[model samples]
Target: MSSGLPAGVDLTNTLLILGGVGLVTLLLRALPFAAMRYFRESALVAWLGIAMPAGVMTVLVMYTLVNSTENPGGIGAALIAVVATAALHLWRRSATMSILFGTVIYMLLVNLVF
Candidate 1:
């Protein structure tokens, strides 16, 4: 009976590998919750919690700007989307709405306007 798997790739080995991966994934997922109590009051953790969002957003914007230059008219659309995203975020203070609207505007510009 052909199991449709590759040669020498038996079910037992596959099951073992999957089990090991599942165990590792569970350990990694639980590690953060386990260590949170120890780092709960740490100043560095608090600082990261506050600064990471802006730092990540800045990196994403820079990456977008850099990549947009590759397309014929992507830079202008990217800039307009970025401005609209910033304005929306500033005015509404909702990250979800700002990001969603920014993505919609960028898609529209790239597909239809640009």
Candidate 2:
């Protein structure tokens, strides 16, 4: 057992610090909901509600595209899928068909070419 932690370190003394940090995190996460109750008609809240989801989606898409090219054949397969998706979307104006077609094309390309 350790009598006391090294300099600048103490698990026993850090419990309260950790708890305070956790509490702050919880409060920050809950702040948007709390603000909604008090300022339901605030333009800032309304704008954030709309923009946040769009921003999240943009980030997710960028992350996916960035992480998808680890393998040698990934770029070609992704290109085929994107082209198929775009074609389906343009020709039929159907998001479901576009996604389905893209997935199928991607799988087929990966299996056959790579």
Candidate 3:
């Protein structure tokens, strides 16, 4: 059977291009996992696994604090939420309670302030 592609688009060339792309995609994804296998027993990898997530969380929290004031009453609500979260954590040392309290406080503050 003849290739169904439009004129000038050779079937063999199209297959080669698709195969190259698939190989590159597979290598790109597998390279990182292969590198991780080498570092499976290393202290650096262990520390990085822990520290990277903590660093990401800290950056996200700071970003939210900084950007919360873009709309009306957002700043005050965020402030209240942060304070409430802190207070809950301080009192009970419970992350779940702190998050719950913080969310409620934030909602209340937003409704009242805006």
Best by TM-score: 1
Clashing pairs in 1: none
Best-to-worst order by lDDT is 1, 3, 2
Model 3: colliding residue pairs: none
- The alpha-carbon lDDT assigned to residue 9 of candidate 3 equals 91
Candidate 1 residues lying further than 4 Å off, grouped into runs, are: 1-4
Q: Is candidate 2 or candidate 3 better by TM-score?
A: 3
lDDT, model 2, position 104: 81
Note each model's CA RMSD in angstroms.
1.8, 6.0, 5.4
Candidate lDDT scores, in order, read: 0.92, 0.75, 0.80
User: Residue 102 deviation, candidate 2, in Å?
Assistant: 0.2
Q: Lowest summed lDDT over 10 consecutive residues: which window, candidate 3?
A: 53-62
**Of models 2 and 3, which has the larger lDDT?**
3
**Tens-digit per-residue lDDT, 36-83, candidate 3:** 878999998899987985586467557768988785567777777787
Candidate 1 Cα RMSD (Å): 1.8
Q: Tell me how candidate 3 scores on lDDT.
A: 0.80
Question: Whose lDDT is greatest here?
Answer: 1
